[model samples]
Target: MTRESWRTRLGFILAAVGSAVGLGNVWRFPWMTAENGGSAFLVVYLAIILLVGVPGLLAEFVIGRRSQRNPAGALYRLSSGSKSWGAVGLFGVVTAVVLLSFYSVVGGWILRYFLASFTGGYFGSPGQYFGAIDFGLPAVGFHVGFLALTALVVVGGIRDGIERATKVMMPAIIVLLIALAGWAVTRPGAGAGLSFYLDFDGTYLRANFFDVLGAAAGQALFTLSLGVGTMITYASYLGDDHNLASDGSLIAVLNTGVGVLAGLVVFPLLFATVGELTGPAAAGGGPGALFVSLAGAFSQLPFGQPLAVVFFGVIVLAALSSSISMLEIPVAYLVDEFGLERRTATAALTCLVLVTGSANALNPGLFGFVAGTLVDLMLTAGLAGFLVFVGWVLGKDAVTEFSSGAGSRVRSLGPAWLWSVRTILPLFLLGTLAVNLLALAGVSLF
Candidate 1:
């Protein structure tokens, strides 16, 4: 059978952006900013995105388009059919599962909050409302529902499933977020929210450079969906005629814009309504901070219920768009490596994630650990492995793929990019990985 290919360049770009823009951008970016040093973290994060994230993205694209296979197979075949390279690809497969295991739990939270928005269900007591529904049987049930939805789409195969779904989803997501962000900015005390989010504080950054740098790097990668083979997998579906460098840059640009837009909506709403920028929401709020906090904010506004529906509905689309990408990794692995049909592979992996996601729903501490630190470590290490493989194994071949179809400007930068990818990027990734691991180990040497 012929390999699958994207129906259009635009479709591939939207699908890639859809994968990049998720709860990580909407929920986690705001929280991480608030937790770290507000705009200081944002500044550093932007720097890292330009410096590390974009180049890393290009590296992945070079690998994917050059080999045109699943990560494991791509690595093995491209590296003289080496088993070790294939093993690195398998690590990416594992990273995908780990990413979705906790991601589904958050998706479920968005689902529940979307439903609750119908009647201001959690209006009077946001804290109790969140705590009541956060984890346990109901959360697990919802997580399963979300996971099932992801599986159904992925099981349908790429064109009919991922492409078709994201085509509809991506536009709706953009419109809803624009509407919500507009409305949020118009709220009373919206100025405070804007101030909190946009206000620059270089002093804060100067005082806590490494701390903020570490966080910004993680959030930047997380927000862009970098380091994971998601970019590679998505790029693998592209035809040779596509301009990989151009497409990758557009995906990065679109995803970053959406993330910034999400922050525009989220930060304003939080400050205007909750009076607390960082930390947990009022008593009704818990793990899924954005859902709880934003629902509460919308509940207090005019036509809040309908707006709430629109808001949560957008979030649902965003989450599913991303979740489908997560499921695709393992699904691709099974189909390419194990010879399973797309439907069969998706079914098996969905069942696996069901149990894993349910475990996250039923346990808050475990969920937090996995979603936060564990995911950071896994993606960091996974990306590190990829950069090394591209820099060392593929070497000149990676540069050839990068320069192909690239404009003269982008093509000229290829050699420098290759050099950095081979040396500095891998070292930086490894160092960050170590710091993250030690921090998780309760022994922060940094």
Candidate 2:
């Protein structure tokens, strides 16, 4: 059987960008920025994205395009059948499954909220509404529904499914977010939210530099969808004609813009309507609390019902975009490695996630562990492994792959990028992984 490839360059770019722009940007990024010194966290995050994120992205692209295979096969073939390196790639496959299990639970919550918005179902008691539906059987049903939607797209093959869906979804997410941000900033008392998000506090940044750096780096990698082989799997379908550097940089910029735009919308709405930005009931109170707070804020507005519909609709799209990518990783692994058909791969993985995700939905303690601590560890470790493989294993060949289809200026930075990936970047990732592991074990550096 022949391999699938993206139909066009634009299709490929949109699909990749869709994968990057997800709940990480819309749900987590805004709250993280507020918790970490606002604009100070933003500054560090932008630096990390440019310095670390792009190069790491290009590394996956190089390996993927060079091999034209899934992560496991790509690493195996590229490393002369090194099973050790192949396992690293397989680890990414596992990470994707782990990610989707908990992520789908959240996706289900978003789907429920989108539908609820139309009828204002949660308007009476937003906090109580969230508590009632956040777990157990109802949550499990929604998780299955959300997972079904994700599988529907993956079973369609490359161009018709993932590529086609993202082109529409990405545009809708961006345009809706921009509109929301514009309306949000004009509300009374919104200036306080804008100040909270945009105003930099140098003293706080200096005092809590390490804390801010760790949080910023985690969010940067997560928002980019690195380490889980989503990028690698996406890149494997590409032709050498695509400029990996240019495409990667554009994806990062667009993803960051959406994250900032989410803050613009969320912060102002919280300030103007909810009149709070911190504490257990505010942006920092985790996803359930944030959703409840935002829902309450929507209920208080003039065109609140329609605005709620649009806002939650944007989140649903964002969640679907990333979920599809997560599902694709393991599906690609099976199809590439075992000659399973796309539909067969999709069905098998979807069923597996259905069971795992239900476990998460029915158990709050398990869900929190997987969603917060477990995911952070897996993504960090997975990216570290990928960087080491690209640097030490691919070595000069990595540069050759990166330079292909790139301009002179981009080509010129190949060696510097390689050195960073090989040395500095791995160290950075490993350090982040250590911090997360320690935190999981009830140890805190800060």
Candidate 3:
């Protein structure tokens, strides 16, 4: 059988964006923004996205499209006489498993909340509703259901499963979000929310510049699906006909737009209802925020139930789209390296994740560590390795791949982009990684 590829360029773009826009956009981005200095943090994050994120994404595309293999195989083959390079790629495979272990559990919670809303399950006390359904056997069951949904897509292979699903999902997610943001902005006192979200308090940023920089940089990479080799794997499916630079830029822009749109709805609603919108609850109930608070908001408003359905439905699609990418990393590694059948690889990986994800579902501290700090560290390191490989190892070839389908304007900029990736980007990532590691050790870079 021939290897599967995306049916069209739009299918590929939507699929990549689907992986980019997920719980990171809906659940975590708001919380991170609220905890940081709000708009000041947003500004820094946006700057990083434009400067660092786009180039890094292009680097991944270069590797993926050039090698046309899983990260492990891509690295080993792209660099001759380097088993260690494959080991670096294996780290990404491990990262995917670690990412999905907690991600699926959270996705499961979204599934649960979606179901709960229609039945008015948590309508009585919205505050306690999150706690009630957060973790237990039921949570595990729903997580398994969500995991099964993810597995089904992976089993369906790239074309039938990932591409087809994401093409529909990404559009639906955008449409629903636009509608929600429009509705949210119209509410009385929504200006207070917008002010709180958009207020640029320089003092807050000046006070926590380094900390915010590290956090925002990490968020920008993770939210764009840059570091995990998802981009590499996705790009591997591309034929030599596509322009990697254009595709990378499009994915980054669309993902960032959706993330900002999410903030627009969430911040305004939280601020309009109650002043300031502090802590995890306002941003997200950790994992439950989107379902719980949004559901609460819906219950109190007219047409709340229908709107609740739309919100959770969007989340379900977004979560699945991203989760499928996560699952694909390891499954592809198994197929490419171990020569396992795709079905066997997916099934075996799904079972392994069932155990790993269940552990995340059963424990809060472990889940927090893996989902928050661990993922940040892993993605940071993974992306740094990819950029270094492209910048130094594949330096000339990287330029060629980048300029292949790019217009003259973008192709012209490839050299400068390559220079930055080689020197400046790596240095910045190393510094951020050191700070994050030290902060984890209680050294307090801030």
Candidate 4:
């Protein structure tokens, strides 16, 4: 059987953007923004995205396009059959499983909220409503349902499933978010919310520079769907004609734009009704803060029932599109490395996540740890290793891959991109890795 590839360039772009613009954009990005001094965190995060995110993204693209294989196979083949590097790639496959375990649980919650919006399900006592549905058997059922939806897409293979789904989803997510933002800002007293979200407080940034930096760095990587091999897997399907640099930049831009747009809707609506950002509901920005708070806010607004439906509808689409990417990583591994059929590979991996994700839905403590610190560490480590491999191992080949199909302007930047990826970028990732590890160990040496 031949390997699968995207049917069109637009299909690939939309799929990658769909992967990048997930729940992080809708939920985590806004909460992180509000909690970490609003725009203070945004400034730091934007810097990191340009400095770290784009380069890191290119590194993955180089590897994926160069190898045209899944992470494990890519590393193994690229390094002249080095089992050790292959181990690192296999770790990525594991990381995807770990990621989906918690991610699907949240996706399930979003799916439920999207459904409930139609009937005003959580319109009463948003906080209590979240507490009721956040964990245990009910959450487990929803998680399974979400996992089923993800698997259904992946089973359809690349173009027929992932690409086609994302083409519609990406557009819907953006258009609806724009409509929501327009509606939100028109409400009375929305200017204050916009101010809170966009105002740059130099004092707050200077005082909590490291705190904001670390938070921003993590969010930057998380928002782009980096450190998870999703991009690597996605790029593996690209033809040599598609410009990786251009596509990557576009993904970063669209993801960021959507994130900022989500803030437009979220901040104004929350401030308009809820009065202020209700952060710290759980560590690393919880669903409670975004989901429950917004649910309550909608309850207060006139015609909120319809607005709630659209809002959660966007979330569901975003979450599904991203989760499909997450699921694709390991499925690509199974199919690429083992030569298993795509459908068979997807089924096996789906069953695996079903059990793992159910554990998270049933246990709050486990979910918090996996979703917060554990994911951060895995993505940080996974991406750092990829950058190091690109620089120290793939090196010139990485440069060639990056330059392939790039415009003359972008092609010229490949060497500089290479130097940074080889030295500066990995060091930056390691520095952040250390900070994450320290924070994990309860040592706050920012």
User: For model 2, how big is the CA root-mean-square deviation?
Assistant: 1.3
CA RMSD, predictions in order: 1.7, 1.3, 1.6, 1.4
Model 3 TM? 0.97
> Model 3: runs farther than 4 Å from truth?
277-285, 289-292
Question: Is 2 or 3 the stronger prediction by lDDT?
Answer: 2
Report the lDDT tens digits of candidate 4 across residue range 1-446: 79999999999999999998998899888888888888788888889988999999989988898899889899999999999999988888898899999999999999899898999989987778888999999999999999999999999999899999999999999999999999999989788888888999899999999989888988888889898899999999999998988888888999999999999998898888867745333322565678877887899999999999999999999999889999999999988888899889999999999999999999999999999888888999999999999999998888888888978999899999999988998888899889888887898874
How well does model 1 score by local distance difference test? 0.83
- Model 2 spans > 4 angstroms off: 277-284
Question: In candidate 3, which residue pairs clash?
Answer: 285-289
**Clashes (candidate 4):** 0
lDDT of 1 by residue, 1-446 (tens): 56688887778888888998888777777777776777787778888888898889988888788877778888888888889888988888888999999999889988888888788788887767888998999999999999999988888777888899999999999888888888889878778777766789888888898899888988888877776788888888877677777887788888877888887888777777767633333423335666566766776678878888888888899999999998898888788877888878888998899998888888889998888888888889888999998888888888888888767897788889889999999999999998887887799675
Query: How well does candidate 1 score on lDDT at residue 406?
Result: 67
Ranking by lDDT: 2, 4, 3, 1
Stretches of candidate 4 exceeding 4 Å from the true structure: 277-285
Error of 2 at 103 (Å): 0.6
lDDT of 1 at 22: 81
